[model samples]
Target: MPKGIYNVPEAYNEPVLSYAPGTKEREQVAAAFKEMYNSTVDVPMYIGSEEIRTGKTRDINPPFDHKKSVGKYHEGDVSHVEKAIKSALDARTKWAALSWEHRASIFLKAAELIAGPYRAKINAATMIGQAKTVHQAEIDAACEFIDFLRFNVEFMTQIYAEQPVSSDGIWNRMEYRPLEGFIYAITPFNFTAIAGNLPASPAMMGNVVVWKPSASQMLSANVIMEVFKLAGLPDGVINMVQGNAAEISDTIFDHTDFAGVHYTGSTAVFNGIWGKIGQNINKYKTYPRIVGETGGKDFVLAHPSSIPAQVATALSRGAFEYQGQKCSAASRAYIPKSIWPEVKELLVKAVKSMKMGSTEDMSNFVSAVIHEGSFDKLASYIDAAKKASDAEIVVGGGYDKSKGWFIEPTVIETSNPKYDTMCTELFGPVLTVHVYDDTKWEETLKLVDETSPYALTGAIFSQDRYAIEQATKALENCAGNFYINDKPTGAVVGQQPFGGARASGTNDKAGSVLNLLRWVSPRTIKETFVPPTDYRYPFLG
Candidate 1:
């Protein structure tokens, strides 16, 4: 390869396909959906160059229709985890030693695959697997994941191009080295894009990754592996495993070679991982980097001066889309009294009109939660709201699990600002609205800020610039991803780098250069053109 200064192509956000009527992409995706839905795939754990299949297995079913078998994934145990670790270590040296441009090329090709041929397949898989509708899958699996791959490659090259300032007689250079040991990527079930990006971003920075995707996300996760393989990624660069979280995490965290963990899941699990790493701090050769994105009780606050239609639409799309499973989904809303009546009427109408069913049909905006546990938890919350005097179901509060884990998109209007439903992360299609006095905007803003432990995402809709400015400043520390006159959900990769502070996450801001920086440890190199003959300083003379 020629050694010369290089620059990556200008990164651009991938356009989301509406998948509207009579569109070619819609037809292709619909066809793929039908094919995938009718088929039952067998998924195996990918370790090194081998696809290992364990005797122990479990069926993978779509959340929308549990009776329909999408696939079956082989479950690996501790021994398999060991092999995965060994495989990663064995491959790290050669993989990391390769030139940065080569690494960039592989992921760039992967992005193209996602953007073109695999787009329909991946989106279909996401729709079937995660119960996401066409629009959600289009934005998530197709656009966001593709953005991650292409932009991450560009970001990687940007990182490699950065050099230190050189002094009079010396040339200074900086190298962004991957972590000494392997990285552990623990992804969640919500976003297929996040699942792929978590591991791929680190691996692109010359690191080996042991990725453990959520059990619920196996269908789309397997597709991601296939796409990576097609991109000519080397074997053992990213080892895919699906199994018991506790067993696998314990095994991975216990290993001496463990360098870091890139996690996106719950707060409890994140805390447990941190505690375990702390307990084993003395055992590792180097300090392990922990980059995580966890839970969010994301909110939307509409001011008295805001337009009711726009505010209602924001809540409808932000909360009900994908059944409010996204961490950044608006589960809580703080509306002022002046527009409360109109906002409620419009919101109730919109929510009532939303179609909740299988993702196979593009008409349905809402679908089933991930599984029974989630369904049960959400159902319990809805029941509690119904029984309690402080909370009232304004639009929807229905659930039916006999067919599939389906819960109607429920909105609870609560008088108690500090109600359990208002603060807790339901992680379902449930939005609790807390109405406050128009004069108490500042106080209500404080209530929104202090109500939840999470600071992931929050939005303020206002026609008044002064009110918007105040909300923006007051809620500055409350949400990492804050939106103005927009919903809290749908944070595009480059434009709005996602993550939050406090209980939300480490605020590493995924999809940005900041997140990529966490995967690397920088080292400086200096080359001297002239040497002092006598090791004496001019100050001494």
Candidate 2:
């Protein structure tokens, strides 16, 4: 295994696997390093600061493997679950009593810590652990997460400053309050930023959080806990327990103190948890808040006047980044037949030029999918596409598993909208392109709507004002977030709210004040200058 640069032990003298700056060899080096680490390392790494099973001190694997890592949490028999809830309940009374400013200060300190000494190591670990390219890892571990922290603090500031007013002699005041019980954060593996938002948002609002991170990205999650600790957050304020899905769900759902669940995963899991919450509704002191962001079959509509180069760049990045594992990743595109040739040519060139390999290779723009399961699923989609009469692979459709779960960036062209490739969510580095005649613009819009049950995100590329306007209005309900002349994947922290309705889980958009609202409950407090001296007034008379 390559020696980790940021937190290498003094006695560790192995040569570090250095990537050639800006060269594709960097991706090769990254893949090589990951392969070595996964195959050679024998110990299971803990996802939290303290090992739950052994209750011993241990150094974390610098570049942990996602697949081989096991859950550090032991099955808490019924008694342990009771103790966890009691701990949270005991902590909440004091945590909720603290001023909002005091709570926000800890998040500010966390942002500072992430940007300072912890930045490099965290970024490196994310790259190795998640198979994210160095640039992608930096964005996930540093830029996006820091932006979320800053945005959350700013949001709390605004919420605190705004005052309620009354016109007459009466006075009314309203303020947001944290749920008096524990908040559970069930996060995904695609983005580390999402992991931070799940718990941190509620934590900033003075709620105790029991975070259950995705099993695939536990190391990245642990690094987040380290940052939170360095920020001086009270230990019990944020507690992390790592376990498998069944174990986690059982523990979280059965625990009476689990007041709220913020989730991002498959729709099935979301619905299952919702059912559990409903079944156990009366067991809790209050109703639990359930917020989720599920699957999305995001689309991109290419008008005839759309610039080929720009649209190609947008589509390529949106479809292939993180191997299209993100919920918002572009999976389908609607192109007018009038400009089909130009669009196809540009897309083919773009996909062909993309360097795909290990993330450590600086020149490689695309990295491996997270694991073998994703690899198999992506391959199945490609095989299914190969048999389609109207569909053709425009770029890549091959996979190699010797070193890592690497698949070639692929593009498929199909004239039939009914093709399964165009209709289903292929969450991988595969794009399905559908062509429609200009006369069928309205029909194509309808097809896009019918094809996706998810209304998460959709984009339009058009230079004409009327075309952009028409498409925007028509597809408005097609996505929670709509974009023009931009990719759907790069939704900013403060600017864009990032969730959708219908099958795409709840519309509790992350990264905005709306999401923060779901984590809290508003309370009304009224104070009078003097007590009412007379029980009877003019109205009573």
TM-score per candidate: 0.99, 0.87
Candidate 2 per-residue lDDT, tens place, 433-490, comes to 8888888877877787888788899988989989899888888777998999998887
Between which residue pairs do clashes occur in model 2? Answer: 26-360, 26-361, 27-361
Specify the highest-lDDT model's number.
Answer: 1
C-alpha RMSD of each candidate structure in angstroms: 1.0, 7.8
Task: Identify the runs in model 1 with alpha carbons over 4 angstroms from their true place.
Answer: none
lDDT of 2: 0.74
lDDT of 2 at 264: 92
Candidate 1 per-residue lDDT over residues 1-541, each given as its tens digit: 4697667777788888878899999999999999999989999999999998997899999987898787899999999999999999999999999888788889888999999999999999999999999999999999999899888888887777778788899999998889999999999999999999999999999999999999999999999999999999999999998888899999988888899999999999999999999999998889999998999999999989999999999999898888999999999999988898998899988988888889988898888999999999999999999999999999899999987899999899999999999989989999999999888888998898899999999999999999999999999998999999999998888889999999988999998999999999999889999877898889998
lDDT agreement with native, every candidate:
0.92, 0.74
